[model samples]
Target: MAKDHGPTVKDDKLYEDLLRDGASKGKAARIANAKAAGTLDHRSSELEDRSKADLLKEAREIGVAGRSKMDKAALVKAIRMG
Candidate 1:
């Protein structure tokens, strides 16, 4: 059975699964909440389909440093690795 993670954890089973999958606490919580709310997007756009500007914007949003110096391919790699 999944251990109780307090009220902040909306979905205990999802949280436990995420934890077992090596997800950080915050990431697990966000995913669990999103799943519970039916807002979790399982599908993502292909990296090649995204524009350089869009990749850069996402990198910036995710706090990827030196994104200004990276090209589209580099941004894609960094975003994936991040």
Candidate 2:
């Protein structure tokens, strides 16, 4: 069983899985909560369509390593693979 992460974490198991997958604590909590709320199914822009800055921001959110040194295409790949 997973340890309780307090009330802010709506889905503890999903949050733990995201953490194991390299997501930051905040990102894991947010995604888990969104999944519990049934709002994670919304569509977003393709990685290519988003600006490099946007990609960097998302990479930072998801705890991608070496993101600062990567270019736009690399950022897209990292974000996708991440």
- Scored by lDDT, the top model is 2
Candidates' TM-scores? 0.57, 0.54
lDDT of each: 0.80, 0.84
What ranges in model 2 sit over 4 Å off? 42-46, 49-82
lDDT of 1 at 16: 90
Lowest-scoring 10 consecutive residues by lDDT in candidate 2?
A: 39-48
Q: Candidate 2 residues 1-82, lDDT tens each?
A: 8778999999999999999989978778878997889976334568888788888988887779999999999999887665
Off by over 4 Å in 1: 45-82
Compose the digit string of candidate 1's lDDT tens values, residues 1-82: 7788898988989989988988777667877877888976544569778788878876775678999999888999887665
For candidate 2, the C-alpha RMSD (Å) to the true structure equals 4.9
Q: How does candidate 1 score on lDDT?
A: 0.80
